[model samples]
Target: MLKTLTKTLLCVSLLATFPAMAAPDGDMAPSDKQLAELYWQGQESLKKSDWSGALERFRRLETSLRRTEPASADAAIYWQAYALLQAKRSTEAKATLEKLKRDYPDSRWSKEAESLMRQTQGRPNVASESSGNDDDLAEIAITGLMQAPPERALPILRKVLQGSHSIEVKKRALFVLSQLDEDAALAELGNVATTSNDAELRAEAIRMLGISGEDTAIERLRTIYAASKSSEEKRGIIQAWMIADKPDLVMQAARSETDEVLRKAAIQALGAMDASKELRQLFDSEKSLENRKSILQALGVAGDTRSLVGIAASNESEDIRIEAIEALGIADDDDSGENLVRIYQAASSPKIREAALQGMLISDDSDSMLKLYKQASSKEEKQALLRMLTLTGSDATLDLIEAELDKAGKQP
Candidate 1:
């Protein structure tokens, strides 16, 4: 009896395979390579970010193969389902997956097909396939930090940071905490800074505290700045100290700072502060060219044009010169346009040369920039000037640029 039953099952399974083949006598089924080719074309479309194109390709591939070999359509079907899922056509992907399981349960694509069906339009309301990593999903949740009102996710992240979680979880939570400035997150980070023995956690807290700028965090940084012997920790302190609004501390950080990078950051921060005699003094006197560049960039954050002439005349490192050129735009002084032109006269380095040209566009009109464009020697410099001019698109400017190109024996 057992042998008879087994024979009957084999006969049925074999019979099931014959009908589809006999119906399509005149039509040649696509070869395996053809099917693979179609599958990849769809994948490429998806890769190019054209989800709809990928879906269309998959559908054609599926239909062409299904007539003679329904099972051969598994990859096409899976890709179709994936493209649909990516296109936010969650309902369609789920339905396609269901059909896949029903028609070809034993196929190689069955596992992913069944799993996707469960994920998208499942009872749990999770509409789509998931990344397998727990940390990824948690990080996706943690993106609530970028949501319009950040107060929502603050408490949950605080718990994750303080609680015993995996390092990945803590890392992602810290990232979200960095985004959030809620009283709760700030309070939790402050408490952690004071109490936690974990150096990494304390560092993370200090980083966030800089953004929050609470008095407690400031005091904590002050203590760390004074007592910590580690160079790395002091760098972190200077990094934090730069973000504060206290102008005096910024000058203190810049004038008497120890580390090169920390001093640069301090000078940058002081430049950002209200330009008192102290900030001006540091900008003029700081010996390092890099530190001076930092000071110039900070001056940008303060939005003052007073330092433009001094920065333009420095004749120091090209980097500092380039930074000063960019700072003219931040200063928003169209009145200083002529100064920028004269500065670029002596500016020979490629970066500073281009920056000075771009700065003129913001502070000078196209007509004024046309004269400078004539003075530009190489194609690269001319290209940069033309690009900036194109952004402004003034007719008078175009006319002047044409005249200059004619003079240079070049075409506009």
Candidate 2:
């Protein structure tokens, strides 16, 4: 069905010709061959997802047709409207399509315009005009029901989900069902997530439940994760739990999950949920370097600047300190700025100093970095600070660097 729609969009460039009409510039208009080339160029742009390019080409064609072949202008006009729609300029597309209909009522392109309008509005295409097909009728009825008052639309959509409708229809019904705030609606979504034969639909249902983020939805996800044996399925449940901010279940999975990958996924989810205190505790007890690095990454994601600073300051291993420094950079909290400068000043190894410079850049500690730059006794340290300022991309620091450059230029 989606492919059919894509083909329709791709074929919009092909058009019928009419007798010559007036040219706005009072000059010879582009021949049909020339216009056809432009049309195909627009189609090529559409194929490449270049909406702006397609819009420009179609608009040029519309202008050329308005002058040289007024009757054939509707095709270009319809395609222009279509390009606007594709560009996400819907208000303009609607107006353009309306103009196409108003200006060319009898033209075949007007029917195409109508179909495009229907598509934009999510209505069934009357242009297809296939009657007596029960499936088609049901789809149309369901579409209408979708737009009806929730009081009226809810029951029918639920029935549609339960019925043996097409997967596409079921997906649509599921979406509508998910929007309802009622317990029954959430239950159906959970049912789909847990039992749907279609993997994609099941994932989508899980995602929708996560999006719901209600207590019941979170509980259902927790239950599904506990009962599911498939790692892929459990991973999906963890992601949903992350979205729902069910940190306790995520923390439990992180600690107790037998699967290494699933455990890591749960840890990442914990980071995303900002469970920094738990991750800090886990880091202190964790023995493996790999696991400790993962904890550092989660701390970065959690952006717990105080904890990251503590890790940087106190971690005994050089590698762990470097990792903490890198994590602090990823965390990007300005609160870590002072600590980063401290790390840079006290570090003996060049690599640790380099890591501290990176952390300072990421944390946007321009003032502290510049102050250190001015106080530096070594040329190497001053040069490093200059590089750090440039790398940080802070406008204020850039201005200072520019002024320093200007002053240096005058000295020689």
Candidate 3:
């Protein structure tokens, strides 16, 4: 559903089978309070974006309320139509809306609903519309972006940005723009990243530039690291650099940075760059538990076979060891499969053993995998076995399952 046209929302679900099942005096009856509470339940469901849920609750109330008094059925019917619209059950919305206008000629909700039907062309019936809640305005704006295409949202977002949007809203708007229209939004974000007083917002703008992240942005980030008064700002810019895959800049900072904290950050950024040279250095020489752990993660992501030994080793923290074990699964090199078996053999603990099992599932070591399948216990452990069998498409396991199913089904 296009977000722009959803500047107005049109749906929820309403049905209570029992309300129409019997009246208090006869087959069906609910007091005004019960009807009001039912309506409130529908409202709650609507807010959660569970339109069908709301519709079911409202329908029961509608059915029950109709028997109590014909005069009140008007409101129930209107909301039912609204729910149908929200469910993206549009044919039903049209039907219910038609019923509303035909049966209740003077309802305010019906008239407004008719207008909604006219306006909602090209809109997916389920598109969210934020109501008159100022406190949730930024959230509404975000919701609008989530629903609206960049073309449609761009205009509304431009209006919000141009208007007196709250700082929070401005930040969210910048993010939405960056995601929706990366090239164009980068220009706007660049202005923010360069000049905004809110360094967090500036950093966010830089991060959102995605693949359009520019050399100018890189240099600006470097300059920010070199000159910013706040440590937080430098950290933010460094993160932005890492996200843009500017490993060279990160390596440069790690080699020459003077401040101990910033130097550590630079080193962390180098590890984050997921570059082979830096990953090797981290695996070989980094002495800090934290730093070595970070580097191992980089190695895992870099998928460099050289780090296979270091990742397979148990010298680092359990967390790093676990990350390294997982990394082997993704490495896809000849020795990667061997390294996983080695880790599996050497690894202890339920967790590392399980991680090793997972890694081996991706390895070509079918013999070792077959052993794990026989020994693994618990549903999750069995699931790992199934994943191994599934991904590898092992003929033996497939034939086993098929044979078992055939025996149960009595197929020849």
Candidate 4:
């Protein structure tokens, strides 16, 4: 059933296309080719078990289609929830599923969402089960060990880690091991993180080390990060640093790491940590335009509106300024609409003004758009505003569009 659903969703995505409508100010909507590229990239990420990467691509795809293609948007939503569930973020997965059901209830993806929702409810309680499997029994034992003395639990957990148990059971054992205060337990967890053959298990152990929040565990992560050659492992360590709230460590990597991917991963981690001050400093000192753009994106993720506004208003590079304007829309702060409108009005470059207009759309500032429509000086500008208003799908905007059409028809 899951395979059939996946094939159906893929067909829906492949067939999705933007309507043949010109965007305001000559800004073009993403072409069908671009959307297909995003979908294929997301599929590749999922095949590699790169859940975060898949989620990001699918989320962008969903946002691109939300206003124009409800069916495609719902399919993206289902994939987003699937990625979240695979990442063990059940709470977020459940929320995403709820959104699909609430907003796209008639969608074919809704039935797949129901199955995912059941999975998000999690495994059955161990105590009530009569015929428990190895994984279930392992969970039960781990639960009992939580109350036992550390000395007793540590030895058993160590054996479990060394045992031929399933990866799921071993993961449970590893997590329990991380909770132990003993040096022996930390060492055992570190060994798994550094030496495990299974990449997924190693990543889990690394995550558990971060969750442990022990200085020793943190030091061990640094050691492993310094020694590892795999970008995936290094990225995992960067995420672990974010979870441990070690922004300074992440900052160190962001500043010194030679790998652009790792550096960007660190920047993203800083953003997730809300290290706005650090991000601001990086943005100032960084010489690479690409890295600077990444910092801007992180700032948006961090909701640093003041910085975004400053860049949008004063950045020397037109491209950078436009990126900042788009970031403002992504930030969607209380003042974002006003700032976007101000930028739109002040921008001399058609591209910059178009970005501001798109920002307004993203921020859903219909009143501001309508105000701009009334203030527009050219027929082209008014037409663009009308098109934007139509996309908003508000009754008021629709009425305004109708009146504008009538007036235009009465003109010479």
RMSD of every prediction: 22.1, 17.8, 18.6, 12.0
- C-alpha lDDT score of every prediction, in listed order: 0.63, 0.71, 0.60, 0.76
Error of 3 at 239 (Å): 3.4
Candidate 4 lDDT over residue span 77-98, tens digit each: 7788888887878889999999
- lDDT tens digits, residue span 237-327, model 1: 6556554455676577678867665676566556545554666688777777656666775676566666756666676566676767766
How do all models score by TM-score? 0.45, 0.58, 0.41, 0.69
**For candidate 3, lDDT tens digit of each residue in 1-412?**
1123222122101111111111111111123333544665776676666778888887887786777766667666766666666566777877887887787787656546665466345455454555325637666757578567666777676676666766667766775675553345556666777677765556556555422356555665666567767655565566566666777777766556555465566665664455778667645765566556445545654667567566567476677677677656645566776777667666677668766665655444455676666676666766666666654556776775676578769954
Clashing residue pairs for model 2: none
Candidate 2 ranges with C-alpha deviation above 4 Å: 1-154, 162-172, 179-181, 213-216, 227-230, 396-412
lDDT of 1 at 91: 85
Query: In candidate 4, where is summed lDDT lowest over 10 consecutive residues?
Result: 15-24
Q: Which of the predicted structures, 1 or 4, would earn the higher TM-score when compared with the native?
A: 4
Off by over 4 Å in 1: 1-159, 166-191, 194-200, 229-232, 272-278, 310-330, 341-367, 371-412
10 residues in a row with least lDDT, candidate 3: 12-21
lDDT of 1 at 382: 75
Cα-lDDT of candidate 1: 0.63
Candidate 3 residue-wise lDDT at 100: 76
